[model samples]
Target chain A: MMLQFNVLAASILSQYTDFEEIDWNKMWEATKETLFMTVGSVIIVFILGLAIGLILYETSNQHSLAANITYRVVSILVNVFRSIPFIILIVLLIPVTKQLLDTMVGPKAALPALIVSSAPFYARLVETGFREIDKGVVEAVESMGANKWQVIFKVLIPESLPSIAAGITTTTISLVGFTAMAAVIGAGGLGNMAYLDGFQRNKPAVTLAATVIILIIVFLIQGIGDRIVRRVDKR
Target chain B: MIELANIKKIYETKRGKLTAVDGVDLSINDGDIFGIIGYSGAGKSTLVRMFNGLEKPTSGDVTINGSKISALKGKALRSKRQKIGMIFQHFNLLWSRTVLENVLLPLEIAGVPKKEQKSKAQELIRLVGLEGREEAYPSQLSGGQKQRVGIARALANEPTLLLCDEATSALDPQTTDEVLDLLVDINQKLKLTIIIITHEMHVIRKICNRVAVMESGKVVEEGHVIDIFKKPQQEITKRFIRQDTNPDSEDTDVALSQLLTEYPEGKLIHLTFHGEQTNQPVLSRIIRQYPVELNVIQGSIQQAKEDSIGSLYVQITGDNDVIEQAIQQIKNMDVEVEVINDVTV
Candidate 1:
């Protein structure tokens, strides 16, 4: 029954799209590349963003460590990155990207630029998340003789989990858009497939199919993120 | 023991240097529940925060248990903080954590073993009367229950000194009484010294044995609670006492001035009765013995610890000699009398 359905769908698809002309193998490969880039960059960005965000939060006050100097430096750096457009940033980071990954035109090479552009964006979100936490809660933990590390891990992070989760969801969805833009440099993804085969060759059906798949991935990501946030948020 | 000697705090802001706490000296003995009453921005909060080293004084020595707290830093300061627990006005429990988890935070910071953390947290939860709600989140609990969780968490480290920063200010009157009772109970049972900062005179009157009244970054008056209530030395202290005692719109001084003008035929006297004298019928006795007629104006009786303090304003009408005799008679019964108006014959 499944084979019959596939053959029937193939015939219908051929009416609108040339099945013989479509490279099914390459399409599957692009789908894998998009997933690989999104997953890898999200992990790196999450860690980098959290560290940068926490430093921004901690040093932003007179009571915290290195309040004056480090806070200013980090704040300026984060703002510089956040202000630059992602497309322009990708081109500007080509040299550093080459030095870091030894290549500048594949899914693996796109990572360094993707991380630099997205981590700062996510860091701002993370900072806002931490700010949502009550200052009294931080003081209460500090009053317990908790060191800086303990206060961050045991109180601030846990208290800001729901906000952080929401930030992660937003960051991940933006990464999907960034991943599509990365395809401009020959990085294999659904974006490349839609551009080369659909737009370049005037195959509108392929473009529609790729867009539908991307939407499905985004919906799944949002659903999972919302569930985790609701589970952790007691308030 | 906690001692603050010449503590001062000055903040440099865009508006210029502002002194939050001026030079002040205070000492709290072992097992004392001392209260500091002040309005907002009066610097009581800054004074109490100095105890736990949360706020560093610009120039002073804060000694707790014979070690200067102001000199400690890093690990030493943190270790000292473990022995000084604090509860905030907002309760400040982590919303993501359950009641049991919130209570276990201090123990976790102190690096207690995992197994003992649960048992000890459970013990504290039970102590604060939150036994069945261990798994409940802070948002699920009422304001009173959240404060119970705060109290439990504060007591988790078995500290000798517990600082309450307007701990019951956000709670309702009945809940405030309940929390105050719990504090008194904890003070008696554990023999812990507590420092409570508040703007409410009734809080000081209810549970505090000693109190200091602060005004404009200075300690205006300090003494036993009953004594302060009976004989307030500062104008601010008198205003606070009157505000607590009378529910009327007019201030006590305004009311007294009005009464003096309206009732011109008698002498207006302010009478204070303390301890056993609060319950005695001293007014009726004086009226029966003397030829003076007594007209009661305003009066209230407040209970402070085991003692009761009462204040009464009365108009006495009679011949000059008889009025003097009646005043002397009331004074003989252990009441303090002050004549507000002296009408010559």
Candidate 2:
């Protein structure tokens, strides 16, 4: 058993030091590219997501505004987009994505698809966060002469921050996961590097290394996410 | 001064249309602590919410000061709402903001400049006796402290009218007294008109100058709190006053039935006293002047709006003529008298 374990360890080491093995500098660049895409998309998602979420919430039956057919139609549209699979959505929007970004398979080109997919996801998160807030809080603010917009920003947003923080954390973790899948469409990231260096070349050690690095990234992201959630959530 | 004229609120639920507030007229005078008392869903909350325009009436008018608020909309309605501040049963302070920030929210929405907002919030916090808690979040405070923060926030804009929707219903008995005392202090110092909605009659007796008793979406009886307590016109109001002033008064009926064995020929009467008329020694004077003997079975004294009021249960031992004359003379003193002769042997 000892001799078999040594052989396995040596074989794994040989895969890393083999000719045409992954360049550490190039691999690090791919990780940086993945980080850039994930962070940028999250920023866009949150800003647009919050605006859309507030509108949806304030336009519902629970708000002072009476529910109407037009609002219901808009809500249906949001729900429909939210139900579409992300990768499938990317395929379906290829024509529009290419037209807008001048290409369909790189960081810049993937920006719109990333936002389109994640904004709806984050909007649902925000809507649920706001929904958990007490209706009495809104009524109290409204009685103070706060108009709808003022109530939303000054009362609703501040009151729902902890829930919103949780929402953002989970959304970001999934955001990083999504970026890995973006590699299947020619986006530059660790996924692309792992595919070419590990899968295409039949390098088992390279594949194992890429998988481990991915796990480490996910672990770090979740740890940071949990710390933030704990700090913000008083409940 | 506030007047609610023939106000009605109908809510359309999926089951059917329910009348939360039926046609009701109410007059609350300036510097008066007016209480609207009822059981849950008796339209007390719905009626109070109308005072601040939180709930619009289906028909009729809400005239505050002089303006008819039911006709106002948008900016006009919002401006009118500024003149009326309200607190809730739940103490709905903004959870994320500090106590000071919560107090400053209304002023900010009302367009108070940045320079004066902090000072105004500080003054209001001091008034509510939460000066040192300005930086604390609502979660960091006790229930009473949170309500104080809510009170300070409501008073930040210096509104002439303050509406309390079951304000102390959420607190313990001790904390309820403290918050009630604070409300009394605010009413005295600021001379703010308060409309309090509560199910507790003791709360009304403690601070309210006048009260309206609601039942089945209507004001069943209303007047000066002293008069209402002394001589309630509605059966429901009478029952509430009876239960509060004498919790075991119901069991007194069993005791009365037993005592009826001794007074088989005597008459039993319930007498009510109100105002300065109660200052006269009526019971002693009856003993001195009448050819009758009076036995006190149950007696109670309750104070409303700083006046002495009470109810007495007595058995009178006298002939028919003497009993009639004695009752007539007692009625002349402006006290209510009722005969409860249904005691089973």
Candidate 3:
């Protein structure tokens, strides 16, 4: 077993110069597509999820801003979306994605499905973040003659920013992983490259290379995220 | 001025209904440092929360500075709340904002122009003796400094009334005295009507002119501070006074009974003097005229409100009937008297 492991390791190490055998331009384009989808979906999800999370927070029974029915319905809807599998959601959103973007095979088509799949997940995370804020902060602002908008913007948002940023970072990292699953519906990214070049062409090197690159990207994003979180979390 | 008329607050818990504050009616005069003293779970906090409209009464009217705080809603209530400031036990300052910004929060919410808000914040910081710590967050300040910041934040909108809910309960003794001094300074300088809810009689004795004793969601006794101290009407009030006046008084009670056995011919009497009578030489006059040797064994002089009230345990030796007549003479002069029995029936 040890000799077999040494032989495999040597073969893989010697294959580095075989980079010319790989499609560099295609890999670059696919990388760009992945970045585009990841960033676009993240932006859309952040806006929608933050709004939804704030709604869920403000309209809950504890801090009700509206009737109980609306709050309950919105909460249930968020739970439902968050419960669905990411891959199934991508497949299920095909017709809607095509109608919305006039295509369902490229990064643009994958954008809506990516947002739909990730928004509710991020919303729940954001809601938890907001819920953890001390109620005393809200009462203090209210006693300061702050109207609802002022309290939400000046006090509540600032108090919860660190946690919300952390939630966003976690969501973005999770979305990167979910982007690979988006490939089942023919969306372009490193996942598609790995599938087409490594799986379809029966090449193990391509799959291993993409996996290492994905791990490196995840670590880099998380490292930067932790630094940002630490800077903001003064408490 | 603040008035809470028949205020009631009930919490529907899982066990059943719990009345946190029951039909409490109180009127706090302007420039009065009113202290509400009670033990834990005594609804002192619930009553104080109503002053700033943080906890709405179940059914009653809370009128402050001519506005019905319990009835006001939305933006009007918020505006009214700005005029009535409150500080908490935990010193709730926004960790995100600096000390200056925290002090300026009310002004920012009220939309004071950006140019004026800075100066107003600076004035408040300086008022609270926090001139140079404007940029520090709450986490960087000490407990007393945080309370000073809280006080500055509470005074930002230039409120007419300041409500403190256990404001000094979380501080050490030295810090408590400093905060109390600061509050007294604010009350004097700004002429702000202050209401302090605490479980410490020492806190009440330090600054309050009038006090209310709360127990089981009701104001058991309320009156002038000297009246309550010289003559506490309720058992809980007496308990508090005893604990404060003598922490070892329980053991003293037994020792006092034993001391009475040594003087059979003496009559033990407890005299309570308050207000102008505290300064009178009436005790000396009685000792001079009557055939009685007055032995003042145990006594304490407590400063309350507008006067010094005292409770003294005295023993008289002479003719029994003469001592009784002398006690009547003292009573005729409007002094409160209680006889301590030397023998156990």
Q: Estimate each model's TM-score.
A: 0.93, 0.91, 0.90
**lDDT digits (tens) for residues B189-242 of candidate 2:** 999999899999888988999999999899989998887887788878977787
Candidate 1 TM-score to native: 0.93
Model 2 lDDT tens row, A1-235: 9999999999878876564666777778778877888888889988988987776776677534455554576577778777888788777878998888779887655667788887877787888889889899999989999898898889788777876777777777777777777876788777767787677977755666666677788788778877877776643
Error of 1 at B328 (Å): 3.6
Stretches of candidate 1 off by over 4 Å are: A1-22, A63-66, B249-257, B320-325, B340-345
**Candidate 1 lDDT over residue span A178-217, tens digit each:** 8888878878798888898878997766777777778988
Question: What clash pairs does model 2 have?
Answer: none
Off by over 4 Å in 3: A1-9, A12-17, A63-66, B248-300, B311-345
Model 3, range A126-195, lDDT digits (tens) per residue?
Answer: 8887788888778777777788789778876788888878888888888888887788888878888888
lDDT digits (tens) for residues B56-168 of candidate 1: 99999999989999999999999889888899899999998899999999999999899999999999998889999999999999999999999999999899999999999
The best candidate by TM-score is: 1
Selected candidate, larger lDDT, 2 vs 3: 3
In model 3, residue pairs whose N, Cα or C atoms come closer than 3 Å (at least 3 residues apart or on different chains), thus clashing, are: none
Q: Find the candidate with the highest DockQ and give its number.
A: 1
Per model, the share of native interface contacts recovered reads 0.98, 0.70, 0.75
**What's the distance in Å from true for residue A196, model 2?**
2.4
